[model samples]
Target: MSTHPQSQRRLHAKGFYDEFPRKGGTASRATHYCAGCGHGLLHKLIAEAMHDFGLQDRAILISPVGCAVFGYYYFDCGNVQAAHGRAPAVGAALARCLPEAVVLSYQGDGDLGSIGLNQTLQAANRGERMAVFFVNNAVYGMTGGQMAPTTLAGQKTVTTPNGRDVETTGHPLHLCELINTLPAPVYIERCLLTTPANIQKARRAVRKAMEIQRDRRGYAFVEFLSPCPTNLHLSPLDAAKFVDEEMAREFPPGCLRDRTAEVAARPAPPPLEPLTPADIEAVLDKCVAVPAPPGLDPDFGTIRIKMAGFGGQGVLSYGMMVAGAGLADGRHVSWFPSYGPEQRGGTANCSAVISGSAIGSPVLSHLQVLVAFNQPALDRFARDVEADGLILYDSCLAEKPTTTTARALGVPASRLAIEAGLPKAANTAMLAALACSGACRVASERFSDMLAQTFAGKPALIAANRRVFAAATEWCQANLRPE
Candidate 1:
C-alpha cells in the first residue's frame, strides 16, 4: 500500500547486492572486484554515508593499489587513483588545492605500510583535512601472498615460509598505535570484520568518520582487519575464527584516540557568498568575429581556409594568424584540425572558418580553401577544394602536381625565407600572401594589427616574421593577383 516502502534491490544469483546508481556523478561505472571481498561491503557503506550526508558532490575518493585500487569503479563520486601508499599524500594535495572537496583516501596494508608508511605518517602529522579508510588484512593479496608490515609474528605466509620471526624480522608496526601519536588526528580505530556484529561496528565507525568530514572536521582514520582466506590458506569459516582469536588479540578492538574536542574548539568555516550579475558579466570571455573591409563587396560568403605541414611547420599558429587577420577585419572565425596519425612527428593541418554569421562547428568541411606545406599534405587535401576556392602551397612541394580546377598559388616558402634572411619565418610569409589574396575579407590595417597581436611579445621574432609577411604580400600582389 505504501509507495515508498523501502530501498529496492535487483537480486542476482548470489542474492540481493546493492544496485549501483546510474545517474549524474563522476563514477557511474560498475565495479569489477572478486566475490566475498570486503571492498564491496565497505563501498556500499561509504556510498550510503555519502548519499545520506548530502556530501556526494564535494567528495573525492583517492584510490590506492591493492584491493581498493578500483574503489573508483563503484563510488558515484569524483574519484582519482593515487600512487601505491601515496593516497594520503594525494589526499593532502587535493585538500590543499580544493579545500572544499571532502577527500577520502582508501588504501590497503601494502599500500599504507610496506611502501607508503612515510606518506601516511607525514599526512597524519600535517593535520590534513581528509578521511582515510585503510583495509588491513595483514598480507599483500594482490601480487601473490606475502608477509605484510602488519602480519602477526608466526603467521605462515608465502614470503614467510617458516612463519614470521620476532627477532630478525622485528615486531609488526601497529598503525593505530602510530597514528594515535599524531596530534592532528581527529579519530583512529582498529576495527575487525571477523563476525557480523563486528562488521556492523566497523560500518558505524566508517559512517562516523565520514560524518566528521561532512561537518568539516579534521583527519579521521579507520583501519578494518579484512579477511583474506585465499592468501591465508584457510577455509572461510576457519579464516573468520583466525581473525577473531589471533588477529583481534594483537590488534585489539578499541579507540586509539579522539580529538573531537579540538574540532569543536575550532571556529566553523565561513559560508560561500552568492555571485552578483555584474560579476557574471565581467567574467564572460566573448570572442568577437572578424569583420569585412570598407571598400570590398560584402556579397561573398565568409572564406574558410586550411593550413597544413610537418609538425614544426607552425600549422596551428599559421591558421590562428590567418583567423586573427579575419577577426581584425570584423568577421566571425573558428579554427580546428584535419590532423591524423601524422600528428606524431608527421604533418599537421588546421582549418579556419571566417564567416559573417556564427559558426556551427569548428571542423573544416570539404570544398573550402586548401593550403598545404608538404607533398603528403597537398596530396591529402588537394581534391577537397571548392571550384572557386583558392589553393596555397609552399614551393617546398616535393610531389606530383594536381590538376584541380581550383586556382593554385605556389610560393617558394623556403626560398622566400632564405631570401628574407630568416628561415623559420616561412609560415608567416605564406600567411601574408593569403591575406593579400582578394579571397579573404580581413582588411590590410587589421591584418597588420593582428600580426602585431599574434607576435606582440617577441620583438626580434616579430621583425623577422614581419619581413616574411611583407615580402610574401609584395610577391602575391606582383605575380599572383590583380590589385
Candidate 2:
C-alpha cells in the first residue's frame, strides 16, 4: 500500500441540522428524496454555499409543496413552507420586510412553472433581491409522473402516455428564455447534473446565485436539469444518461444573462420603529370621528356576533356599526365580511368580535348573538347561537325561525326604518335592538355617536339613522321582553 496521506473526507455541511428530528424515523440522517435523486446533491451544494458564506444566521428558506417540502426539517436556518405556487410571493415579502435576510426560494418545475408562473414572473419583474433555485426534472416526480411545463415536446408522462402533443397541449415552456426577456433580473442561468463535470458547473452556478443574494443584488434565477429515476422508470445511470442526452438537447445548460458585475449592492432599509401610544392615539383621532367614551370599562370580557342577509339589505354595514361602537367604547374589535360575486342580489354575511382583551382572530365560529335580515339568513345561522344567547330577525320574514337553545325576537326593523323616513337605515334599527336587548355590552347611547362618525360627510343620513335607532329602541322596550 502507498504511504501517501489520504485526502480528508468531507463532513455534513454546517448549514444543516445535526439531526432531523422532524422526520420522526430511524433514518433521520437521510433525506426523503428517492434513491439517486438529484435533490440531495443540489441541497448539499446550496447548504455548503450558505455555510461557506456565513449566511446561515440570516438565511430564510421558503419551501414549496413538492418532494422537497420537507426542506424545513434539514435546513437549520429560518424556514417557512409556503403554499403551493406561492413561494415567490412569500419570498418577496420576507425580502422587503427583513432587508438583512438572505431570502431563498426553492421550488420544483410543477410548483414554479405551472400554478406559480404568474407570481414568479411578477417577483422577477419587480427585481426582488432574492435567489430562486428552480429544479426542472422534465416530469412531476412527487405526484406521480405527470407532464410538467418543462416536459419535452415528445416526452411521455402518465398524463401524456402517447407523448406530449404540441397541437393539443401547446409547446413546452422555455422558462429561462422567458425570464431572459425581462429587464429586471440581474442573473439567469441553466445548469445540468448528469456528469461529474456538469455537476461541478452546477455547483458554480449555485454559489454564484448565493453570492448575488449576499450582495443584495436583484433577482437571480438558476435552473437545474436534474434526474428523477423512480418517476422515469429507469435506473440511476439510465436516468442520468437521459438528462445528458435528451433533456440537455431541449434545455441547453449555460448562462443566458449575467449582469452581476454591472449591478450595485442595494442599501439596507432602515429599521422599523415601534409605534408609541401617543402615535397610535394621533392616528386614531384623525381616522375616528367619534372620541372614545370617557372612563370606559376595559375589562368587559368578550362577545361574538354574526349578521346575515341579502346583499342589498346592509347586513355587513350593521356588523361594521357594531364594531365601530365597540371601538368607541375603548374595546378591541374586529369585523370580517363575506359576500358573493353579485353586487346586489347575492347573499352577504359578516362577523364581529368585541373584547376587552386582545382578539386572536377575526373569524367567529359560534356566536353570542345572531341578527338575520331574511328567513334564509335566520334558518342558516340561528343554530350557531350559543344556548344562552339571543336571536333577532326581521319581523317581515316570511316565517318565524324556531330555535331550541336561544331566545328569539322579531324586530320590525324594516317597518321602523320606513316610518323613520329612510329604508336604508334598517341596519341602524337592528343595531338599536341588539343594544337595547343587552345582547351586546356596548352602551345604547353610543349608537348616535357611531352614526355621526359613520356619516361624517353626509349630515342627512346621520339624522335619518338616529330617528330609526330611537324608534327601534322604543318599540323594543314596550313590546319585547328583555328576558
Candidate 3:
C-alpha cells in the first residue's frame, strides 16, 4: 500500500486530509511524512485504539503542536487542535464537557516539557480525569532542528549546532521519573517505537491507557521515546539505530505510575457545589444555569455548530459569545476550541452545540449554517451543510461559491465593522448574519450582555462593540429580512 513521493503528491499537500475510510480501518493512511518519523506510528496506534474500542462517537482527542498537529485530519473521532504546550488543559475541558467520552492529550517534548510543563505535571498530580500521551522525540521537528527538553547530550540540532553541551544545554528531561510522584493516575508507562518487537510492547501501553479511560479511572500517562530523522538529517535506519544506542540509555522505557487497583478499591472524592463547567459536567449528565422566571422560553431545539475561519478571525471567541448568550437564555451550552497553528496565521475554528437536553456525541457533520472567511475554508467544508442549510461569506473576497441547496449570502462584514468603529470586528458581523438565518436565536440584549462580559475590563471600548452588534443586526434584518 506504500507509494513513492511522486505517486502521493496529493497526500502530502497542505490541508490534504488524504484518507477517508468507510468503516473500522486505519484512518491515518496518508504517508508523505518524512520516513521514520515516530509521529506516524504513534498516530496509527492511537487511531487504531479509537476505532477498535468502537468509541469513536464518544472520544475527544486533543492534538498538540509539533509533528502531531495533523492528528485531527485523519482520525474519525472528535479532535481538538490544542495550544503548543496546553493539550492537558484542553483534555481537562474535554473531561468536563463530555464526561462519558474518552479524552486524550497528545503532546511532544518541546510542547510538553518546554512550554506545557506546568499544565502536564499539574494535571497528572491533581488526577485530572483524562489520559495524556507524551511523544518524547529527543529533538524538536517542524520548527527546524532544536534541542528539546529530552534531547541527548551530544545530539546536534539547529539550536544546538555543536551538539548539545551538557554544561549549557543540560541533560535530558526524565518525564517518567517526574510524573511517578503523582498519586492519582491509574497507569503510566514509557515505551519506545524502535522496532517491530518494541512497537508491539508500545501497543500494550497504548491499550492500558485506553483501558484506564474505559474504567472511568483518573489520570494516566504514557511517554514514548521516538525518533525524528528529518530534524536529525539522518537516514531512517541510522535514526532507529541512534534511538536504540543513544536515546534509550538516557531515558529507558517502563511504567512510571499506576494506581488503577487502588483507584477502583478507594472511595470517590467528596462532592462539592458545582460552579465550574467541569464540576457540573462531572456531577450531572447535563448542566444549565438556574432557569429564568416562568415567562422565559423553557425549551429549545438545540443546534450544534462548527465554525472555521482564518487566525485572528475570532472564530473561537465569537462562538463563546453565542454560548454565553445561550447561558443567559437559560439553555444548556458547550463551547470547544481547536488551537495551535490557528494562533499562528493559519485558519482557526471552534464547535459550539447549544442544546435543550444534555448534549451527546459532539462530533458534528451536518451543521445548519456554514461560515467561510476564505476560499479554502469554503471549499473544504461547504458540502457538509445539511440540505436546505445556509452559507455565509465575506463578499469582499472572490472566494465564495454559489450553493444550490443552501442559501448563500456574501456580506461586506469587515468594511461594515470598520464603519461600526471596531475595525477588527468582522467575526461579530458575520455571526450576526448567520444568526439572522435562524442558526442561533441570539437576542440583541443577550449579545450585549456577552459583549459586556467579554470586554469586562475595557469599559471605554464597550460602546463601539455595542454599536457594532446593533449595526450587524440591522444589516441582517435589512438583508436576510427573516419573515
- Best by the TM-score measure: 2
The TM-scores of all predictions, comma-separated, are 0.52, 0.57, 0.54
Worst 10 residues of 1 by lDDT: 7-16
Task: Tell me the tens digit of each residue's lDDT in model 2 across 322-408.
Answer: 899888877888999976432124578999988887777999888888998988788778888888888888887635666547888
The alpha-carbon lDDT assigned to residue 476 of candidate 3 equals 80
The pairs that clash in candidate 3 are none
Instruction: List candidate 1 stretches off by more than 4 Å.
Output: 1-31, 265-483
Top lDDT prediction, candidate number: 2
lDDT of 1 at 116: 97
lDDT of 1 by residue, 46-150 (tens): 777787777778899887887666666566688999878888878988887775788988888889987999999999898888899988888887655788998
lDDT of 3 by residue, 171-213 (tens): 8889988888777677889998889998998888887787778
- Give the distance in Å from residue 384's predicted Cα in candidate 2 to where it truly belongs: 29
Pick by lDDT: 1 or 2, better one: 2
CA lDDT of 259 in candidate 1?
Answer: 72
Decreasing TM-score order of the candidates: 2, 3, 1
